[model samples]
Target: MNSPMFTRTSQQESAIQTNKVLRNTYALLSMTLLWSALVAGVSMAMNLPRPNIIIMLVGFYGLLFLTEKNRNNSMGLVFTFLFTGFLGYTTGPLIGAYVSADMGDLVVTALGGTALSFLAASAYALTTKRDLSMLGGLMLSLFVVLVVGMVASIFFQSPVLSLALSSLFIVFSTMAILMTTQGIIRGGETNYISATITLYVSIYNLFISLLSILGIMNDD
Candidate 1:
């Protein structure tokens, strides 16, 4: 009998399909990341300052959200890449400052750690096929708290508060990794694009949080 869901394909064919999806995801991810770095470099060359951070950050989020919501088409990929590039430009000042600092190399270290952690999380999720949908609400709440905390900190400007937030973000990002990993494993076949975006965000935010922590510790 023919299945309504997926056709009964041979193991080799299934493997080929899975590999193709993964390959496209990785290729797009890598290309976008490279473009992001290039954009950051070009922005710096144009003498863009960090004080313009708010506009860049807000714009990136706003546009990315809108773009990603409609990201199933070609335009979605274009916006995703553009959003990533803007994010790189926004983060470049921080990256530059971090490198200029005495312990700036910590950024690179955090990046390596984040990469390893992301890989491990994804691999585990793919193998286990466990559902992590439970984390959706929790993750949403965490982000809300972080956003509120940041707004409050504008007036507070307490280094201690900043440290606490950085630490919390680092922890929360790690948790997000788990949720995304599980989703990737359980639903990888159904929506590879969404899964790829989810995984990319998890890794990117993890690196940012780790960078925050490293930069903070260096400041102290």
Candidate 2:
């Protein structure tokens, strides 16, 4: 049996640890995002060609796997940056295409929209401090549906359907941000490196999805 003083000390320690993890996660997230943005800018400036679909798939999955495997140590930090940088490089071609088409405003608008959505979702989760574990199953189901839709689009070559998938991805990313933030605040996520990676991926997807929708709408 624990004494009252011991219980209080334990609770305080837990809270401190949780706060530390949250702080570290956000700090690392900010740095990784800046790094990614720099790489994307360079890639865009050089007009770098996008990687082939197969290369993109393998690089993304491989880096993600490495990051997860090393997530408890400094190696996770290195892998996380590499993964985000790779994603940013892939994004450069799409952004360059939009710029070349004189749709730079669309890209800017998409960036603004992504920022706003992330802030809104994060704020709600942090302020309410509600448990979002229930969203886990729902998010997983939506992800499967999203993957299926994407595969179908590749085969069908339907612009209309591709646009629809972008819209769905935007929704999915929003929910992901909310659930991830809530998980951190509720002590469900302890590792800052893994949490940062998850949030970064959601943000990356959010930006890409928004950019796709904006480009399609502008083109139409």
Candidate 3:
């Protein structure tokens, strides 16, 4: 059996490691977000055509898989930026559409909302010691439902259903932020790269969903 001092020292070391991971994750996440924004801005200025849905889906999932598979190495960081840049590029057409429609203000508003929501969720998770692990299963279920709803709405094209799905995605994204933050604090997520990717994707979805709702509401 270990002495009390040994156990105490081990705990302290673990705490330090967790803090380092958290700090690195946040640092990388900020840089990736800025990089993504820059790419999106360039894409918008070029007025690039949006990739087809099939192409978008393939690129997203393929890059995401590569990122996760390499999360322990430098390649993870490379793939993370690639995946995020791809996503940002894909969003450029939507931004162009909103600007063309003279609804640019709505994009700003949605971005503000997404940022505020993320801060709130992250703060609560950090300040509270509550174990958010229980939320994992529930979040997974909600995610599946959200995906099904999104796919169905694509086919049915009902405004009410689409709005409801957007609302659901907002909730899912907020909970995901909370869960991801808590996972890091609890040391369940040891890899900062994976954590950054998860949080980035959540924020990305949150912004897109909010923008969709705003666009629908402002439709003339």
| lDDT (CA) per prediction | 0.70, 0.89, 0.91
Q: Which stretches of candidate 3 lie over 4 Å from their true place?
A: none
- RMSD, model 1, all Cα superposed? 3.3
On residues 1-220, what C-alpha lDDT tens digit does candidate 3 reach at each position? 9999999999999999999999999999999999999889999999999999899989999999999999998999999999999998998888989999899999999999999999999999999978888888989899899889978987898888988998988888888889889988988889999999989999999999999999889863
Rank by lDDT (best first): 3, 2, 1
- Native-referenced Cα lDDT, model 3: 0.91
| Order by TM-score, highest first | 3, 2, 1
lDDT (tens digit, per residue) of candidate 2 on 130-165: 577888898899999999998898789876897989
Q: Which of the numbered candidates is closest to the native, going by highest lDDT? A: 3
Clashes of each: 0, 0, 0
Candidate 2, TM-score vs. the true structure?
0.97
lDDT of 3 at 144: 92
Q: What is the lDDT of residue 166 in candidate 3?
A: 84
Candidate 1 vs candidate 3, TM-score winner: 3
lDDT of 1 by residue, 1-220 (tens): 7564456465556667666666676677777778877887776666566656578668867876866686678777877776777777776777776666655578779879888877776676567645666767887898899999988898998878887887777667766767655543333444455555665666677778788777677674
